[model samples]
Target: MTYKGIAISHTILFLIVAAFSVEPWYFLMLSVAQILFVPLVLKLVLKDDHLIYYFVIPAVIAVSILQITEDSRIDSLLALIYLLFTFIVAMVGFKRFINRGFTNIEEFAIDMGMMYLFIGGLWFVASVLEIDTGFTPILTWLTGIHFHYSSFLLPVFIGFLGRVYKPASYPWLTAIILISPLVVAIGITFSTLLEFISVLLYMIGIYGFIVLAIKVTYKNGYQKSLIVTSFGALGVTILFSLLYATGNAFGIFGVTIDFMLKFHGFFNCLIFAFVGIVGWSIWTPPARYKKLQFPISKITGKGTVGEKILDDYHINKTYMGLVDDMSIFVDKESLPPMISNFYEQTMHYRLFSTVHWHAWFKPFAALYRLFSSRLQQLNLPFTSREMEMTGDIVAIEDGRTNTRAWIRKIETSTIFIALYSIHTRDEKTFMNISLPLPWSSMVGILALQEQDGKLLLTSKSALASDAGIYLAFRGTIFKLPLEEQFLLEEENKILTAKHEMRIFSIPFLTINYRILLK
Candidate 1:
């Protein structure tokens, strides 16, 4: 049978079981999810045919058995099978996410939705086996449903909506929506107050999604209406959620779990999930992710060794500035004259740097310095001794992404061979720097700012700035948990600068620079 045919037959069988089952009609909620909603969503987000999805058939059968079975061991084993299917789906999502890298918010949302299904599957298993999950079995089952819809389906829907039209507030709103599921779970497990707060956050994100849905121009009026109705259903159900959360937090008995299951769950599944699935199926928007094709540093594994064996590209060995013109990237009018001049006429300046390794990371730094010195990469002395930096600037003839190689050396030992380039996205320009490593590169996207006559560049920027440190390997880039700040100011006709590096928000190294016209 075709995938669609099987899904329809499985859903029908589950509905029949629910119709005749003695009690626990809520199992019907999970039945539709296992057989229909999840498959449709996987079809949408997954770009290619995956063998893992075939497991969904057995998973459907397992969920069907759970709906009518009274045997404890059988239910547990069946739930385990379903959980394994979800685990496979999650792995597929994780692999997809890694291949694409951290580029688009819409795609990220979709990928995250795929990964979240495993959590839903885990909770489903726990609910069936009667695990001591700190909550009653009913709550546990409800939690599983919560993840399937809110964590999984909602994100996928929002992602598809984003492919159609993304508003300015979409990223922030999506971020809140993405993180709220975990926050809600944390709140439920620990604090009522937290649960209430998370519900409020979720409500804001869902309402924001509704506003965006109205703004998105659909293929036809019917599709738009369906999409709007789907979001609208969530708008109402989220209110129910808020009410329930408020009651639970404050000891109010107005809204109960039973009321939520009957009303909230019904509207969400019928209107939100079913209608939304049909609506998107009418014309699912094309994926927003395009694999980044910008050339990475070909020199890998101790760049000094690889430098001798260059790629099939022209490299003009010359003494040049970091940038031909600072005005091309930022407003030259706002920048300090010395700062602007330094970049435009970089070779005319002499560089000196004092490296400071933070106390907490000195030991690691010392160990790395031993290996790094041999590779002539990021090799800074442990002591805070000022060293003169001398290097040659070479222009790389890459028309797509105009780049330069700035090889800096401290007394004959190569410290950095940073390939500098510029990337413009959404009308904002970023400074892209790549340092070659073993079959990979450390990439830093820096956002520029002029503040109080000083030039401020940071990997961590405010919203709208695609600025972050990342690691690129085999055509895929992923964010690294690191931050770097570079502050430059002109003092007494000389440009002084401080470069601070941190990992997980803890300072590890700093380089103070003094630049003078030679």
Candidate 2:
């Protein structure tokens, strides 16, 4: 119903980020986790895990073997495994780009983050596997850190900043933020002059982000100190990145590992990771505790150009392969009722409400709520607010070849589905996606026919993998996907689905909801 899903392992990425920075024996293991497991954890968040999960299954055993075995040969073998997985996620990001599946800006930036992770992954394999690359072994190790911090984390945080600031309106600045991370990573590998240019670009991107942070805070009634502290750390964070990039290019500045570990490492691991994981977590609005009610009042003035531009985005996502399956099991007259219920029931829990956290976080959460309460008063510009939420499910009809559906709405409710077939490479393949609209996501169901012909439905194709969430914040930017299901019985009633509230496939809460046209 919404892009909002719970991830039990939402903290997995942050934990990996924090754990590896301090450098433990498992640091080598966690570094790989950042890429392989981060995506897996994200799958729990997005609730869309595919074959990629199966590919990384061996990592659990390999990591365990790694703890007991310190042989370089074994390490190389494990790196090889992780290297293959990294390539897979990188390819996922690439294919998404080619298809233009990053429907919005922050989603687009996160895809780029995947590629940078591959860059870091490459260095990680080289250092751990001890491949005979031209660079010194230590440099390979440092390069791994460089890609993780500068190339990987930089873009990811920038993507978050984009959500907070909405950088897409500023075309030139968005272009710089998007392009510099990759160019700098490539430049580091080949040429000094190129790396220098790339670092300058990278610095400029950071500056742009800082400027936006200040503006968003001041205009939006956000707690100024929190934004300042986070971006201020980011400012110094990128400076260390610049120094490292400079030293690598010129081979002159004595930027020792120890020196970097002390200042660069301390600030980035603490400030960058902490602020990103915690600061932004606090900054973003939580899901609404109650349905967001749009009052019927005198119409406001003409909508802005930005609003119209966003409303016109072309989205062509379909699961046509399942048409036959739907035809075989679904009752034709049930569609309108099912759709109506989906439309109304889901709206009750629509976006900007809550981030369910554990009881212990109350004191800290109270402080955050104090800030959030104030910020809500300010009508600061948010990209999500720009897009139109009004939608229509025009018709759901019985057709010769398949059931016809013409629908358009925001996110999962995108009732504006045009006449297009979402072609997949295989019959059962799942698309790697993260929708940009609030309370929106791709919906697919696995339908099975009972002996009596009653249909049973499940959200995922299989229980491919599972994640353990050590943290569940009530209103954290709801991401994780849930293990949910739906059913159809009577023609006029539409569909019967256990609208399960979940994080990381674990149903924390649920409701028996019915969608009906009447």
Q: Could you tell me how far off, in angstroms, the CA of residue 172 lies in candidate 1 after the best superposition?
A: 0.6
Where does candidate 1 have its weakest 10-residue lDDT segment? 302-311
Where is model 2 more than 4 Å wrong at Cα?
1-68, 98-103, 167-170, 217-228, 244-253, 282-518
Candidate 1 lDDT (Cα, 0 to 1): 0.82
The segments of candidate 1 whose C-alpha lies over 4 angstroms from its true place after superposition are: 1-7, 20-23, 47-50, 302-347, 352-415, 420-432, 444-470, 479-514
lDDT tens string, model 2, 148-169? Answer: 6655555555565565556444
Clashing pairs in model 1? Answer: none
C-alpha RMSD of candidate 1: 5.6
TM-score, cand. 2: 0.45
lDDT by residue (348-466, candidate 1, tens digit) is 89999999988999889988877887776666777798989998777765443667778788777787878788878878777888877766778888888788889888988444356
Worst 10 residues of 2 by lDDT: 292-301
Q: Which candidate ranks first by lDDT, i.e. highest? A: 1
Query: How many clashes in each candidate?
Result: 0, 38
Predicted structure with the largest TM-score when compared to the true one: 1
The 0-to-1 C-alpha lDDT of every candidate, in the order given, reads: 0.82, 0.46
